[model samples]
Target: MSVQAQGREIRILALGDSLVAGYGLARGEGFVAQLEAALRARGIPARVLDGGVSGDTTAGGLARLDWALAETPDAAIVALGGNDGLRAIDPAATYANLDAILTRLAARNIPVLLAGMLAPPNLGAEYGAAFRDAYERLARAHDVVFYPFFLDGVAAEPALNQPDGIHPNARGVAVMVERILPAVERLIEKARS
Candidate 1:
C-alpha cells in the first residue's frame, strides 16, 4: 500500500472524522473500503487507507498529522472539521488546524482532495459563514482539489444515513464514492505526475 510502488498502485489516505470512518457501518461497508472497491471497478487499482478517527477535530487531526504522514500516501482526502463544527469550536482555530495539516501535506508533496463540510445552521450564521469559508480559502491558497460539501446528496436523506442522522449508511457511502470518484481519479493522476 506504500506510494513507493509507483504506477502499479496508488495509495490514498482517507483522513478525517466519523463520516470518513463510516461510523456504525459494517467492516467492508465503510467509506474507505467502498471507495477502494469503486476505484477498482472503474479499472483504477488503489489502496485507500483508513485514517479516519471518530469525533476527530481538525486540531486532533493536526496532533496525529505525523502518524498519518508516516504512511507515505500518494495523495490524501482531508476530511476533518466536522467534529469541530459540531462542538462549535472557533472557526479561526479550525482554520489554523486545517491550514497546518494542509501545509504539512504539501511539504511532503502529497497531492490532496479536500472534502469540505459546512457548519450546521444551529451554530449561528456568523460562525457558520466563517466555518464554511475556511475550506475554500484553504483550498485556493494551497492549490488543492476540493469537494465543496462532503454530504451533498446524502445530507438530510434519512434513508441514506444512520438513525443518528449524521453518518451515512452503506448505500449513502456508495453515492458518495460515485460523486467523488472523478475528483479521486484526478488526485491519483496528480500523484502520478
Candidate 2:
C-alpha cells in the first residue's frame, strides 16, 4: 500500500500460459488486467505485464524468457507448466525448462513468484508427483515465492470455469486475483526493498 509514493511504477511480469493470458475473457477481464486493477485498488503503484501465451508450455516459456524480460520487470510471476502437464510431457524435461527460466531470472537478480501447477489426476500418481515436485524444488533452489496450484479455488468447478472447463471465466479470474494478491503484494514489497 502507498507504493505510489515511491515515485515509480512497480512492474511485475506475469509470465505463463492461458491462465495468465486470460484466454477466453474479454480484454480487461484477464489475469494481468484484474491483477493490475487489484494492485491499484490497494493504492500500490504497479503494472502487471501480460507475458502469457495461450498454449505455452514450460519449454515455450523458457524459449521466450528474453522477450518477456524486455519489459524489464521489477518482479516476476512464473505461471507456466500447465500446457506441459496437459500434453503429458516428460516431467524431467518440464523441470529442466522451468529450471532454466528460474535460473535466468535469478541471474538477473529479479525476484520471482513461482506459481505451481498440479498434473491432471488422470496422468497417474507418479506423473503428478514428479510434475508438481518441480515447482517446490525450483522455489527452494531459487529462493522464490511459491503459490501452489494456480487454479486453487477455480479448478474443476464448473461455475468458475469457461465452457471448455479448462480456463477460468471472469469470476474465476477474480477469485485467482483475490487469492494471489497477498503473494503479489509481498513481491512488490520485495522489489521496493
Candidate 3:
C-alpha cells in the first residue's frame, strides 16, 4: 500500500456487460460482490463499483464511462466486448471502443485491470482471431494489467454455467473471482502507488 493510501477505502470500478452485471445471479453472488469479498478477505480495504449492464456492448460501455467516472475510482476493471462478440460486431469497432475506454481511464490516472473476452465460436475463425487478440493489444498499448479471457475456468463448462450456458452460476462466479483476485490485487497496488 502506498503511504498516502494507508487508511482510505480503495474504490474500484468494474465495467462490463451481463457477466459483470451478473444477469442471472443474485446480488451477493455476482462478480463485483465476490471480488470485493475476496479483496477484503486478503485484508485489502477496497470497494468495487458495479458498472455492469445486462446486454451492454463496448459502445455502450464507452457511452456510460463518463457517468461511471463520476464515482472517481482509484482503479478500474474493463470487462466488455462479450456481447459484441456474441453479436459478431466488427472487430475494429470493438477495438476502437475499448481503446477509447482505456484512454479515458488513463487520462484520469486510474489504474486498470482489463478483463478480456473471446469471440463466440460460431463467429468463424477469422472473426474469432481478430476479436480474441484485441484485449492483449489494448493491454500492451495502454500499459494496464490484463486478465485474458474473463471466463477462463468457467466458460463452456456445463456444470459451471447456468442453463443459458452464457452466464455463470454462483459457483462459476466464485471460480472467476479466485482466478482474477491476484490481478485485482495488483490493480489495487497500482492504485495505491
Candidate 4:
C-alpha cells in the first residue's frame, strides 16, 4: 500500500540486516510480516515496511538511506551494524554512518529506534568493547531511543537460532517482535504526536 493511503497509519520502516529480512525464514515468518501482525494484535493501526537487505552493514545502510526514506515512514527502526561487527569493521566508522543516518531522519522529523548489536566475544576484548560502545555513544549523542542488544534472549540460544547459527528462526523472530513491540509502540505514539 502507498504511504499516502495509510492516513494516520503508523508507518514503520524496519531497516537493517539479515535478521530484519528473515534470511532463513519463510516469507510470512520474516520480521516485517511478523511485526505487522504483532502491531495488529496490539490494536495499533500500523504498517511495517520491509527495508531490510540481507548481509547489509551500517555503511551500506547509509548509502541506501535516501531510497529507504522514500517510503516516508513516520518512524524507522534502525537495525543495521550486525554485518559490520561480523566483518570486524572499525566501530568508529559504524558510529559515523549510524550518526549520519539518524541525523538525516531527524531532519525530516522522523523518530528512530536504534537497534544495537554486540560484537562476539571471540572478536577480542578490545574490538568487542569498541563495537559494543559504538551504539551507546551514538544513541546518547543523538538522544534517540536505543535497544541495548537486538538478540537479547535469542542470540546464543540453539532453539531460537537457525541452522546457520547466524539468523533467527521463525520462533525466534516472534520472540524478538514481542520483546521490541513496546519500544516500537512508544515510537509510533511519539510520531503521532
Over 91-165, each residue of candidate 4 has an lDDT whose tens digit, in order, gives 999989999999999999999999999997789999999998999998898887788888878998989999888
Residues 1-193 of candidate 1 have per-residue lDDT tens digits of 3233345788899998999888999999989999999888777779999999999999999999889878889899999988998999998999899999999999999999999999888888999899989998999999998999998899889999999999999999989888988888878888887
lDDT of 4 at 113: 94
Whole-model lDDT, model 2: 0.92
TM-score of each: 0.95, 0.96, 0.96, 0.95
C-alpha-based local distance difference test score of model 1: 0.90
Q: Write the per-residue lDDT of candidate 2 for residues 1-67, one digit (tens) a residue.
A: 4455676889999999999998989999999999999999888878899999999999899999999
TM-score (C-alpha, index-matched) for candidate 4: 0.95
What stretches of model 4 exceed 4 Å from their correct place? Answer: 1-7
By lDDT rank, best first, the candidates go 3, 2, 1, 4
Residue 45 alpha-carbon offset, candidate 4, angstroms: 0.6
Q: Least accurate stretch of 10 residues (summed lDDT) in model 1?
A: 1-10
Backbone clashes for every candidate come to 0, 0, 0, 0
Error of 3 at 13 (Å): 0.3
Question: Distance (Å) between predicted and true CA of 6, model 2?
Answer: 3.4
Of the pair 1 and 2, which is ahead by TM-score? 2
